[model samples]
Target chain A: MSLNPLHEIHTRRFSRNLGLGLTLGAFIAIIFGLTIVKVSRGDYEPPRAPTATEATQ
Target chain B: MSDVSINSPEFTGQGFEGEAQFGDFFALLKPRVMTLVVFTAAVGLLAAPVPVHPFVAFCAILFIAVGGGASGALNMWWDADIDAVMKRTARRPIPAGKVTGDEALAFGLTLSAFSVVFLGLASNWFAAGLLAFTIFFYVVIYTMWLKRWTPQNIVIGGAAGAFPPMIGWAVATGGISVESVLMFCLTFMWTPPHFWALALFIRKDYDHAGVPMLTVTHGRRSARNHILVYTLLLAVLAIATAFTSVGGPVYLVVALVLNALFVKGAYDIWRRDEDVSETDNFSVEKKFFKLSLLYLFAHFGAILIEAVLTRMGMGGWT
Candidate 1:
């Protein structure tokens, strides 16, 4: 039997791996998607700059 | 037949003076598996009833992730020979000769100790203890002990994969609750069908590798039957979790929809004729496997949504 290249092993399970990988990728996408939604919904605000009096104190 | 005993270490110093690149070492961590662990663990942390210091939560997840990676490295070291024979895992670092067994063992052990100790410092001993136990269960119980010995390995050994969420909860609450246990049960019950579906399609790989996966030992018909049974049980447990503390209308709806699809996919797999060959593409088995992935992430995603809603005082029953 010819030696199988190491890369081929991962390639061989492409569909199966993709099925799992896509789930994780989708989770990441959902996180970013939610962040966008939250921002759009005005749920997030930038940290306020300190007043000069508070800063001096 | 080329077979190496699991207890013995085989170090092939084959790749450039036993030197491995960063990617090779990283591959030993099984990044794909780590992704699942991290996501579930993060969900657990976020979904907890108690408040946490954001820094503490981050550290807990980071250390837990390190512990998870440690388990992967150790598993790779032990299963290198078997990994080499299976087409699905032949490219793994140790099996591919990119990293040697000795290196993997040392790397795994070091990270394991570091993760456990620092996690205790960052969070609570309870979470750290759970993390330590999760690593032990994966490496010692599942990989070394059960995997080669029994066809029911994945069924019994799936506890390792299910512990992360509980560990994450402990990180926040320093104790267990009905909600955490329910989450654990959801993942635990889901494991068999998810893995068995993959096994249905890749049965030949296990045959070649001499691993005693259910498919290889009992044949395809039994594996299919087992998948259907487990998926049915998982459906009940998953849906029932919706009434618990961590769940609400969002989680309940998600559980209702996904579990229905999951049960249907499993039924389709069960109805397949055992003699159905690979040339037909094992389409049903493959589709069921894909559905299984969504079954998990979607449930956890819903739980996270419930947590967010509850934080906003819009969750659970009145």
Candidate 2:
């Protein structure tokens, strides 16, 4: 039988714990960065004012 | 000589040990939680100042729901061990043996990757990024770390659950706004009280599972105090949200009434002793638990109604 020591170690050390942490951290950073860039574009164009169709009873 | 031994037939199954029903796959997605996510995301999309194409809006919400479901599957896979020990959770698909842990892990990872990639392709990167973060936060930060480590788990972990509405808003506008943050804050503040009330009643289950819920680690009295404190904060946040772009006369009325009832319920739970609670005819804990669910749904429902009214130009911020 062939044994895969590296696979076992990778699963124990990386796949189970630290990998999730690192991935989550990176994901949050990306969101924050994208939000900052979007906000900084100086494009504050709010949608057109509510129309009469919107105001109808 | 007349005695005959009975032989049992050997069982051969294609996959895992237990049978995986169609329902099991659905359960893995945590349908109840997915419903809440979908509703909130819909409200966010509708309430946004910017207009999105109807078809695009629908696609965004679909992706958000898929992301939420993927997070749930990952959560179940990771918490299978603890779930097996808790009576309330023991019957969940993974812990109940209807699905193998490896199968669940693979399912979750595949969905997570697919949902993020597809959402990014379908919507703007901003919304996709939020969805991805939400999934990661729920699976990695909340489920794996905070849940088992501290009584403050729900307080911080609540952020993950609160992101759906913000993501929805981003879908429409391609950006974040103060209004969306307030919506997120509403759910974030509400979570501690909601979950702590359940903890008060299920301390034994958490204790047996060694999960370190506030009630188990800090004592029931402390948990009750925490619940009241967070509930008060939640009431303040909920009512204050009424003044934002999303708020109006209708939502204000709903928020005021709901907050009053919610605060009273929290106070009642805080005042009762465990011994008294056991002997009392009315289980305050149980009442509080049921009310908490209603409280969240009512708040979100009110938000949706306000959005509809605003869209119809009948009421809302001009």
**Which candidate has the top score in DockQ?**
1
Per-candidate Cα lDDT values, in order, are 0.84, 0.82
Off by over 4 Å in 1: A1-57, B1-18, B277-279
The worst-scoring run of ten residues by lDDT in candidate 2 chain B lies at B2-11
Distance (Å) between predicted and true CA of B147, model 1? 0.4
TM-score of each model, paired residue for residue:
0.81, 0.80
Second chain TM-score per prediction? 0.94, 0.93
lDDT string for model 1 (B103-146, tens) is 99999999999889978876789999999999999999999999
Per-residue lDDT tens digits for candidate 2, residues B1-318, read: 321111112222222236464567668989999998998899888888888766567767877988899899999999999999999999999888888898888888888887778677656888898999999999999999999998899999999999999999998888899989999998899888889888777667998999878888889889889989988998988988898888887889999998999999999988998888778743888888888888888887888888888878876766
Q: Which stretches of candidate 2 lie over 4 Å from their true place?
A: A1-57, B1-17
- In the order shown, the candidates' DockQ scores are 0.03, 0.02
Supply the TM-score for candidate 1.
0.81
> How much does each candidate deviate at the interface, measured as C-alpha RMSD after superposition?
12.2, 13.5
Query: Cα miss at B227, model 2 (Å)?
Result: 1.0
